[model samples]
Target chain A: MSDLSPAALSPGGTIGILGGGQLGRMIALAAGPLGLDCHVFCPDPDSPAFRVAARHTVAEYTDTEALKAFAESVDVVTYEFENVPAETLELIAPHAPIRPGAKSLAVSQDRLSERRFLAEIGVPTAAHARVDGEDDIVAGLETTGAPAILKTRRFGYDGKGQTTVRDASDAERAFAAIGGQPAILEERIDFRIECSVVVARSEDGQAVVYDIAENRHENHILKISRVPADIEPRTAQEAAEIGIKTADALGHVGVVAVELFVVGSGDDERLIANEIAPRVHNSGHWTQDGTAASQFENHVRAVAGWPLVAPHRHFDVEMENLIGHDVDRWPDLVAEAGAHLHLYGKRDVRPGRKMGHVNRVRPRER
Target chain B: MSDLSPAALSPGGTIGILGGGQLGRMIALAAGPLGLDCHVFCPDPDSPAFRVAARHTVAEYTDTEALKAFAESVDVVTYEFENVPAETLELIAPHAPIRPGAKSLAVSQDRLSERRFLAEIGVPTAAHARVDGEDDIVAGLETTGAPAILKTRRFGYDGKGQTTVRDASDAERAFAAIGGQPAILEERIDFRIECSVVVARSEDGQAVVYDIAENRHENHILKISRVPADIEPRTAQEAAEIGIKTADALGHVGVVAVELFVVGSGDDERLIANEIAPRVHNSGHWTQDGTAASQFENHVRAVAGWPLVAPHRHFDVEMENLIGHDVDRWPDLVAEAGAHLHLYGKRDVRPGRKMGHVNRVRPRER
Candidate 1:
């Protein structure tokens, strides 16, 4: 992918987004100021991104005719999530260029491959082993021990498609919980906190990483994200370096987020890579109000082949997600001073669904 | 209009915009974050606002059927520009309430009426007289004197429909230039500087005014506006008070701009009202990047019956318009540090057409 010539997108060019969710809606919002038009292709007609996009095609990703028309209409293609099938990419690649490329997607789609890729690139990750069946699970438990997590190798998100294995007997139950899919057995390491580093890379290998964001999750769903993560300067630097290295190795042409866990304490504290999200992550939402260049805008710029601006954080920010019934407090939140509310325009608020997020910024001196 | 009860709009409610230009586009952009959808109604098929709006109606303003359909689709109605005909407002008013009401539009539409309204409200304005024809122009010049301006009483903007009268002999030519339309003759005051105050008012008479912006015009079109206008504190306060008074007098439910001229020197300095814009003004464009709450967002909140936030300036800002060929420098401008570019997405760049604007912000302490 790096050897391929990078074509710069003009202001009037259209960007095709694969998923029409909150992330795609935000990217479309940012693209408007840059004089770029957005065309969203999503299977759901009720997708929130359609409201803000210049054009949208409501069709399944597997619909070849719809995908062909969408690709031909856009100058560049990008996706909001990493679970897009490789076959869909293969179809779109013949018409329009897909940023972050297939290598990043392929590596991050499966948990086993992501862990192996990180280790191959000298990025430290949790101890894990690929599990195939009863024998593989028995062998994995013998090596990694009990109190490990049995996660399906593909299509897992927000703690779904995975379960904790307390002992040898629990392995079979965990496997059954995941519907007997291919899985990975990993030791659950005790860590101080969880944080993520979002980095943007251009086609020519130039990369810029945002400040670390400390995230707190409830029910495996992101609840709050605060920028200028509370970590030693050395740990922050190491996290950024790991993010850049991961993006560079994948030849990614858009934003990539690397989730990491801080292990140990004091001088011995170090970052351990936990997971890789080859697209915009929820943790980076704080950058919208905290920094001069937001992750979404930077991704648009990188994929558009424009020079990247150094991400500068001018204010301390805390972004809180409004999930499910939490959005019911919107009337009160709208009146809160210094709070910038961004509702996704979701019509239904099912339990555990992310409806929107609010960003609050305070001056650094304050 | 005040007797009509104010209804607060929910987050998902739709706002109907009367014109589809850069202002409408910006308002639509601001509405998205507040969880509001926008529907633009304009006659021009090439309208830039249509690209960002969720819905749009393309029909002449006189088309009552289209107007009724558009009005019924929206919860509240507002306009980008002030030239909308009174008849159009009458048609929409039966279905949806028009913010800023008909009084603001009626007064600001005709120069003679605006001057009279300002004077009646104790707001000092430039000396002027109504001109019905050549005889009126001659009689007006006898009192206002030479070196005065002859401008159409209605439908005049950006130096159009007006001419400069240098001497008595120029009266006939000036009247002919305006096509014998009813006009106003005003004495051109020697002013040290030009500035404007943008004030937003809610239905209940609560008002918030942005910082004064020093303006520079090229051929009567706004070229640049710098916030924290160079003016005495007393003059700035006076200007704000005048803006609030004007908005209150008209029972304006949205944003209103009052252009003023600074006269005298030292302690004798004072502000003289020059013109009134019953909608968002170009000079307030700086608020988009320089303040925590932009003028556009404030306008939306006011018209939506939401409480207004105090216009707080977080940074010193200079907003420069990219008119006509000036947009050609976008490639270079995009690379400039601390510069936030907002392109209007206009397809054609005719001379004097407002292509876009760029805002440069500097820290207040710096």
Candidate 2:
């Protein structure tokens, strides 16, 4: 049964995904056509990814026995989100090769570490300082200025675990708002637009970067991502460079996304790195309908040690996330011509939960 | 969790599939993005569809208990192939609403009934006659004449269960070749090209037809299928009409593929209905990359009782099947820039077995 074939066919193995969310579901869906089966290991029994994956084990990330059994059964492991506990990964690491490795997770999982890593890579970021104690908060505010954002360094996402520090005096209250966790104070840049560069990196260091997607947020959750970002050509190129450089620095295999804030206009337009998602990010979801290949497919390719495709974008697209009750508009979306709808199969209608996305495309203007 | 939603969001339920091949797998893959779960039922323990489907029952079609249990579990039922037995459909019909119906299966499962159905719909078909025994062979041969093909009325696909009769003397020999099963003798129509019109029809009777795809075969098995078939515009329009008419007449609630044989040149060109695949056909695989919504997606749409999209072809596509060892060239196929490859996770490389397909796309010429 073991056919010693090359990476072209993806070796027909099972990809064990750590998180079974929409990202994991999309990845499994892409992996299927490539002859790779996915075994989704998520604690959530109602996880949408479990439907599409070949197999699944419902156990907490901290369950060593379950993690070891799952890791041993698959060829390689990849994740949909970065908050996969360090101990869980450590338990599985010796049994299976985890792509975009532990270091990428360690860095992205913590804001302070992520910011430090960005600085080491020479990527420009918002002015920031770490805050552990009350004195540190005052000291960080002195550097970042009042009205900076106070964010918990760990487990912050979708604008959660963060609050605005109105002033040095208000920093303590903002810190307590995030449960007084270890945090960072960062000077928030006033940017023209938010955009993301999603790049897939192979284990061999080869990379392919997707066009930057200009994003819009509602309640700190991504609402819309449009490609052919409204940015000067140089900024897009620089953003792509940042994505590639960051992935290469982390020895990243699979898709890594860098969210950038376009801070200026015309020649003065420069990008400030905001965050790095160590997996396929929402902004790159546009690629699923805009290009010949998607970030999910590229992630599967990189994770399988296969060749990554340089996909050509065939259309200018606008991808709108179907948050909560927004999925109920699916009928109108499905009926609309040129609208590509993707529902994540999440049955719940939690107010901020991502239910799906619809990508509306128009012919690219040459 | 049971949120009552419109057809637009797909309502998130399990789609019971009656077969577990690449087609079923692709259907499940498409259904996932629409938030529909698939429960594939196949006797093959190593079925490719099992990997993507939410749940699977590896029990034979003759297993009535399993069929009942499977059918009762899903909201609706559909199949990948036409060979799903009459008794199996009868068993499932009571438990779930079957898309493309038992009647479509009955007609397609038998070549004679299929010919009659086409005739009743005012569609052109090659001259054919039924042969149940030796006496009927000579009589049917007399009507169809020399140089005809003897096909068993049931269980025939991929060039199986049929043989060509050279002349009157060869009629009995050809009949014997097919193991003397109840058969239909079809007059060999000299064809300029072989093409297919893949159409999806909703439960409400709305239909959308794809552009005719010209197919090339090797050893009676499909080798290549290219869109924008080498036919006149009027012929393509007529082929699409045939597809719509056939699907509507069969009361189809999913994709139905109508194979056509084009005869003669220019103004004199005409089509003869060759075969009807009452499911997502292999020839329609190009839609995965050539159009926004695929045949599988359309099938998913129809079966879910949702509104189907009128998909516009975005590229000129050429689809080549990866049969058996041809899949071993995955490296080159994966590396090919314009090529979109799909590999069914069938571990063995059996000769003539469809391993996967690749659709190469280029900018559509105006």
Candidate 3:
């Protein structure tokens, strides 16, 4: 049989990564065992991914020369985050194939584009309207209704660049609070719980959606993710479908994670797709020790054009992120039985910063 | 509780590893997620471990100046192989604490000393005699019985530096075959099967012995290791006891592997201790995917003065080593549903060289 394929990379092939945070660090870590090397390109000199990567290019994303050199040196290009500038992708496009491609990146970068794309795919999202200025806020509220959140259309994460619009009168101040940026207003849905589905898609359209993870956030940062989500089995299946649909729609070649709001409970439970992260995400971290192949490994496999590992989870897992000073408890965490600890090699622990995570695994009861 | 301990290292600590083969490479890989960095010291510039490590020192093992610098730079030191010279350890001892200490290294480096030490610990080994010169081979053969194998006392691995003797008549030829080195003659074991036990020991003397693994060899190199070895429960328990006893006797602070030859069958089955490896052995590689903490991770945890995870078996596993051109089968292996592939980043593929391994995991049967 022929051992060659169009997008398939041999063992020693190099993968170029755009960000150098924990997610990039983990993807790079996962690549090493697969005999794949990584060249991490990031502006920060002290990026965590640099510690484990075979190569690191310390240059701004906008620097075309550095981006070109980095792109040419690798077999394929992938990013850890969604905010990579379009110009950067344009420059790298001539050199290496970028997985999850430009369309997914562009759609996920802007809130308006993301919701519109979700709507176009027949996926259910919250009622939302565009707000370009103070005058548009009233019209946006008229469509979205009161008690909505006015969020910036671009460059927002961790609850930043957003504010609460209690009513029509509160729209002007909320719009001013967000620095008059292009924004979208959405009616706040009082969901029963928050959850996410992580799915990996191969170049041939084969996809593996991990078990939906019920999530809890503190200060708008994901604090914990538990597998075997409390949602009904039907709701879980529906959530996974949303993830696979989003991946197929984007023609994504790597992992895609969709954050959803479970609006009801038991037989009435319904999922509302809220956000799409086109990369290996924190909510899926439980797979590292709970399943056969983690999201990181599947992402690497997908981008390298290898077959995806079906998510065969062996244990019920609860992944807790050690944010900020919470990481100082590593001594106790590492000593705990059944706790699989993964600490990003970040020396400083600032408040709200993700220092590491611990996956607590137990024998599957179901 | 206070986070300070004598041998314990903090999250950002560096571990200085001696030897840079696949074992060292895996140890470095395991350290990454624990927030620890590694500095690999090996003479070969093309060492496989260098790619995954944060720092690499390419220098001769006997270079005291280089060894001293490497030891002083890291919180602790450990070796991936037993052949680390005595003088090298003496120099490094003044700078950093070495795991699987000098005593364990000394015992494992020489075949006679290893057997003698095992005997003193109430372990069973084959009857053997030493031969320092060609003339002594006859006496050694007579003591060990006619058909025997003469193995060098030092620097031997993977069936290298040894020869087999048919009887006393073939003594001179067999002695000459091993370069007339200080050797030991052992009665050829006509055994039912070969197996191994891997045990990890912490600084506090806590030990966790894994289930015995039955091993198969081709061309004297490990070809496969299957966990839940087809041995009686009593025999398996006895094998684990030998592993833990050996580790505790030497005050070993990392992983220890004991290879054993099983003789007879059913009620008469018994174990004959053969060789001891002071580092993680190939027989334990199955743990990477079949268990919560891999042998490499457990070894890192032990050497780092962290707590050890009890051997918690999750799957019945068969780990096959892909030697030389066997790695050319990566395309097919990666596509296999239950196979977890790990390729050592070795660019060359000379015959008998280990290129990678695949762990085939299945649900536990017994």
lDDT of each: 0.89, 0.90, 0.93
DockQ head-to-head 1 vs 2, winner: 2
TM-score of 1: 0.97
Model 2: per-residue lDDT, tens digit, A11-79? 478898988999999999999889998999999999999989889999999998999999999988899
Report each candidate's C-alpha RMSD, comma-separated, in the order given.
Answer: 2.7, 2.5, 1.1
Q: Which ten residues in a row have the lowest lDDT in candidate 1 chain A?
A: A1-10
Clashing pairs for model 1 are none
lDDT of 3 by residue, B199-316 (tens): 9999989899888999999999999999899888899999999999999999999999999998988999999999999999999999998887899999999999998888788899
Per-residue lDDT of model 2, residues B78-129, tens digit only:
9998988889988998988888798888899889999999999999999989
Q: On residues B1-366, what C-alpha lDDT tens digit does candidate 1 reach at each position? A: 122233888778999999999999999988888889999999999788888878899999999899999999999999998899989999999899899899999999999999999999999988888999888877888777788999998989989998999888888998999899999999888898899999999998889999999999999999999978888888998999999999999999989999999988679898889889999989999998888788999999888888777888988999999999999888777778899989988998899999999999888753
Clashing pairs in 2: A331-B8
Model 1 chain B: weakest 10-residue lDDT segment is: B1-10
Regions of candidate 3 where Cα sits further than 4 Å from its true position:
A1-4, B2-4
Candidate 2: DockQ?
A: 0.55
Q: State interface RMSD in Å for all models.
A: 6.1, 5.8, 2.1
TM-score of chain B of each: 0.97, 0.96, 0.98
